[model samples]
Target: MIQKLQKKLEGKLPGIESWKRMAVKSGKGESIESESLQKYSDWISKDKLNDMRKAAVLIGLFKKNDEWCFSLIRRPMNEKNHPGQIALPGGAREKNENLMNTALREAFEEVGIKPEDVQIIGQLTPIPVPVSEYLIYPFVGVIDYEPEWVINEDEVEELFILRMSELISSDNGYTETWDLRGNKVEVPIFKVMNETVWGATAAVLSELIDIAK
Candidate 1:
C-alpha cells in the first residue's frame, strides 16, 4: 500500500481543488463547511489566506503488524488552541526554515522520528485554516519501521500509529452537527483510534486517501 501511494504521489497531486470536491459533500451533496466558511470569509479568501502564517505537518508512514501505518498525535489538554485535538506531527514555520524542514523538525520534536530516517514521498495540498490563521502544508513520508515514540509531553499527550488501510476505508468517514464558535454546522469527520479527526488534519488525510485511491 505504501509503495502504491508513493508511486501515485510521484505524479500530480489532487490539491485543494480536489479536496473541495471530496471533503465538501457529506454523502448528500450538502457542504459541511458552508456556514463556518462564510463567517470567516474576510480572511478565508485566496489572497488573504496566502498572507496567513505558514505551518507544516508530516504524515509519517511506516510498516507495522505487516501492514502500512501512519502516525498522529493528541495535543496536551492545556494547549491554548485545539486542546486535546488529534493531529499530524507538525507546527508553525520557524525563522529561515522552509516548510518541509519545518515539518521534519516538528515531527522529530513531537514524536521522536529521526529526520534522516523518513524518506519523503512528496507534499499534498496546503489546507487553509481560517480559525487558526494558518495555511498548513502537508508532506507524506515513509520510514521502514515504527520507532519507539518518545512523546514530548508538553506538546503531545499521546501518539497513535494507525493503519493506512483504516484511513483508506470509507466506513470511517461520517458527518455530525457541531457547534463551532456559536453556530452549529455539519462537520465531516473520520473516526480513527476511536477519536474524532476533523478540521485541517482531516483535510490533509482526505487528500492522502484520494491520492492512494
Candidate 2:
C-alpha cells in the first residue's frame, strides 16, 4: 500500500528531496530520520533561527461521500502575510496556544471546520519556513464524513474542496517557475483542477505523501 501510494503520489508532492533522506534513517523515536530532526539541525546550522516563532497547521483530510478530499483556501488579497495564495487550514501560534490548538483555532477561523469533527491521525515533523520566521508543525487529521464547508470571507477568498484522487494523479503533480530573489527560480508545484498548490503547503504535503499518501 505504501509503495502504491508513493508511486501514485510521486510528483504530486514535490521538493521533498531532503525529507526522503530523513525517512531513510527511521530509528524509531522522537528524533528519528525525519524532517523535524533535520530542520532542527538545519536551524542550529543557521544563526537566525533562535529569533523565530512557532506555528501550526491542520492537514485535514476527509471524504466527500466516498471520494477523498482535502480542504484548501485562497487567502484574502488584502492580507499582509502570504496573501492571495492557496494554502491549508492554519495560521500563527498565539501567545498561549499549543500547536494542536493553533491548528484547530486557525481551521475554524479560516473556514468553518468544527474542532470536534476532525479525528487527528498523527503529526508530521515541524517544517521551518525561515523566511517567514515560522516553524510550522503540520498535523494530519481525518473527518469521517465531509461536512458542508463555508469560507470566512474576511480571511478566505475562496474555499476549495480538492479531491485527493485528482491531486495524486500522475500528470497533475509537477513543478513550475517562480521569480524569487533576482532570478527566475523553479519550485515544486502541484496542479489540481484549476488551482495551484505550492510553497509551504506543498512542502508539508510532501512529507505527508512520503509518510502515508
Top model number, TM-score: 1
What lDDT is obtained when candidate 2 is compared to the true structure?
Answer: 0.68
Off by over 4 Å in 2: 1-40, 44-51, 170-173
List, residue by residue over 1-213, the lDDT tens digit for candidate 1: 667877888887766544553344443557766554553455545466656799999988888888888899999999877898889999999977999999999999999999999989888877777568788889999888897788898999988888978887844548777766675666778887898888778878888888887
All candidates: TM-score = 0.85, 0.75
Q: lDDT, candidate 1, residue 59?
A: 89
- Which residue pairs come into collision in candidate 2? none
Top lDDT hit? 1
Can you write out model 2's per-residue Cα lDDT over 1-213, one digit (the tens) per residue?
324543444434333463442232222223122555456676666965546798888867776767767788888888876878888888888987877989988997888788898876667666666457687877767777776776788888988887766765723346555565554545556776688776667767666655554
TM-score, structure 1 vs. true: 0.85
Error of 2 at 196 (Å): 1.4
* Per-residue lDDT of 136 in model 2: 82
